[model samples]
Target: MSEQLPKEHVDILLAAAIAAPSMHNTQPWRFEVEGHVIDVYLDGSRTLPAEDPTGRAMRIAAGAATFNLRCAAENLGYGTWFGLAPYPEEPDLLARVVLEPTGARNDDLLDLAAQIPYRHTDRHPADATPLADDVRVALLQAAYAEGAELTWLGETEVHTLLDLVLDTDLREIHDWHRRTERSHWVGGERTADGIPSSALGPRSTSYPAAVRDMGTRPADRLRDERQFEERPELAILSTYFDDPADQVVAGAALERVLLTATRAGVSASFLNQPLEYDDLRTKVQRLTQRPGNAHMIIRFGRTRTHTGTARRPVADFLPEEQS
Candidate 1:
């Protein structure tokens, strides 16, 4: 058997993997290296039960990390092969990435890998300027290349989607348990995981904004109100199926789209409140007028804010080797 991967390379790949965004920034992923194969597992103890009852988001987040690891490995002159749920008995094992020597480098993936460290989830108000046609095409193609579909939302469709998002807000507000569960993750300090107050964009003005309001705590008085962009551009990413494997690939596609947008100097935020609920999610799908599960709803444009949440050190998520 080939010797285990070098610690230095493993660290770099793991770092890139952990940088992936998870639902509520939970960072619900763990890594274990066995020989040349590195495995990804869902940290069930960190699961957001109320927000992700079906465990869909956990799988998606894991796939996003897997995508990043692949990109990082390729950039670093190594090739990676990933098998989702490689073992039938180990359901918690989300993926397995095996590293092999490969000096070949794909310039495009390398470019995306470079942006991985710099991509920040911009919740700040975006400029109302629409993206150029070519840029939009590239982003769509990015998702397509990863085996997902991207649909640009029209003005009417955006209005419908916004209404669904509003309903989602109401639904969440009514469910105190879920709300409380999600709020626990809105941290004040700059911890390795969880969205900090600094990264939480300014509060939306009195009126409803086309973005999610993760809600600030009373003690978080420093977060002043700001007007979000009007008529922000929106898109729906979808997959033909809603199974575990489909969700995984959709996540990889979502990351590809995000990285492509970042490379184009575009910023994005998730208006995924509706996607979390079945009733509201059905309405969201209708807006797409397509056949597939709407994996994510994205609002994107330009933003001056470069706020970013921190990821836990790789050591925190990786298993220690036994002597």
Candidate 2:
């Protein structure tokens, strides 16, 4: 076995991992450090049955956290090796990551680590300023580097996606279970985990909003309503398959893309309502007209910096013995 990482290094790694974005900032991942290996697990209790009945989102969140761990290790001058769904018996074990000392480190990942603390979901309306061509290509390359494909939607495709989002929102309007789940994790006072109302952004005044409104209750109405940009830039991140492992790949690709955007002074938010339903998810995939299952719907543009959501301490994610 490789030499065990010191407690301080493990703490640094876990802090970066939990900063990853989840469906509603659930931070639904746990870590176990044995020697130099970090086992990533889905905290099943954090699963949103109504919002994610199949646990796909939870696995994706785990994958994203794992990606952050890898980046942090690289930044710390170590090479990272990881496998997804490595054991059949341990279904919740989403990934197993091993870090080893390497004389050379991945400069790309190291740069991404610097942006981790700044990468937050920007829920506010973005300006009409268009994304530069180079920035767009870089975001695409980031996803490709992680074995995933990102497709930026055209005007017609964005319209189609907006329609799907509207349909999904209408369907969710009466889903008491889903609403309750969202209420628990999102809005209200700032908690160690989950997004708070302050980060929810202003409600959209237009119908078929380009961004998915995070507001859940009548209290959300008290926030100002603003008109979102008419032509919001959108992209879909996907993998060739829809298996559990592929979902993790999608999440890693997502964090890479998001961090890349943050490095370029661009802001992003998710319009993922359509992806929660199987039928709507299929339609979202069709919008891309590509050969992959859509895992995330991202809206990227320029916006002012907003207060980031809070995260639990590193000890909160460790086992009792480790803590």
lDDT of each: 0.84, 0.91
Candidate 2 lDDT over residue span 1-323, tens digit each:
34779898899999999999998999899889999899999998788999899998888788789889999999888899999999989999989998999988789999999999999999899999999999999999999998899999999999999889888988987899998988888888976988888999998998888877787767976899998999999999999998999999999999999999999999999999889999999999998888879899999989999999999989989999997
Each candidate: RMSD to true structure? 1.7, 1.1
Q: In angstroms, how far off is 228's CA in candidate 1?
A: 1.6
Off-target runs (Cα >4 Å) in candidate 2 are: none
Worst 10 residues of 1 by lDDT: 213-222
RMSD to native, candidate 1 = 1.7
> Candidate 2, which ten residues in sequence have the lowest lDDT sum?
212-221
Displacement of the residue 156 alpha carbon in candidate 1, Å: 0.4
Please give the lDDT score at residue 270 for candidate 1: 90
Model 1 TM-score on a 0 to 1 scale:
0.95
